[model samples]
Target: MFHYTKLDIFCNDVKKFADADGYVPEAEDICQDFSYPDTQFKGLKNWTQHIQSSVHATRSAQQKLHAWQNRL
Candidate 1:
């Protein structure tokens, strides 16, 4: 499975989903390995649903928290 960090979340990019350590997985890998609960989508529809998900909001907040902490 591919691991990703908040920095990898790109709503407007074709090549999305990167590892926290900066490894960008291939599109095929992403399709085969990535799974979100109760949803099956592709393309812009997938991105749209993702940004609206609770998981996305939570992760985004966590990312912000980490950034704020680093600045301190």
Candidate 2:
């Protein structure tokens, strides 16, 4: 798991973590437009929520299953 104190750091870390883990997100799960407004913090908050969503959970499980199968 990755963690960061700052939102920018967190976002960057997510990308790195995903790449390192070979996490290929589904089309609808892409957050390429994430932008944090100078006056608000909704972008990062939304991203945080997105990763916790059921769809993401399903995708993660599928990835794990694939990896486990490949190992067999």
Candidate 3:
């Protein structure tokens, strides 16, 4: 039996499920078996819109995302 006393959410196993977008590290350069969720909205842009309107995204998080976008 195992006893758990701490909540360590940053473990590697948890990271695997952290992907909300269809970001394949190697989208087309190689092979992949992973699948990203798709709804009425398709592609990353639409998915982002859904998150923004429904998730009540914080300003700081939005600014960070904006910075990331600018880098690209």
Q: Mind giving the per-residue lDDT tens digits that candidate 1 earns over 1-72?
A: 233343344322322433334333433334334444334445755644544453454455456657776885
TM-score of 2: 0.28
**TM-score for each candidate, following the candidate numbering:** 0.28, 0.28, 0.24
lDDT (C-alpha) at residue 21 in model 3: 41
Candidates 2 and 3 compared by lDDT, better number: 2
How high is the CA lDDT of each candidate model?
A: 0.42, 0.42, 0.34
Tens digit per residue, CA lDDT, model 2, 7-65: 23223333432422335233355455333333432476755564565345444555655
lDDT, model 1, position 6: 39
| Poorest lDDT segment (10 consecutive residues) of candidate 3 | 1-10
Candidate 2, clashing residue pairs?
A: none
**What are the root-mean-square deviations of the candidates from the true structure over C-alphas?**
9.3, 10.8, 12.8
10 residues in a row with least lDDT, candidate 2: 1-10
Taking the candidates one at a time, how many backbone clashes does each contain? Answer: 0, 0, 0
| Model 1 lDDT on a 0 to 1 scale | 0.42
Candidates ranked, most accurate by lDDT first: 2, 1, 3
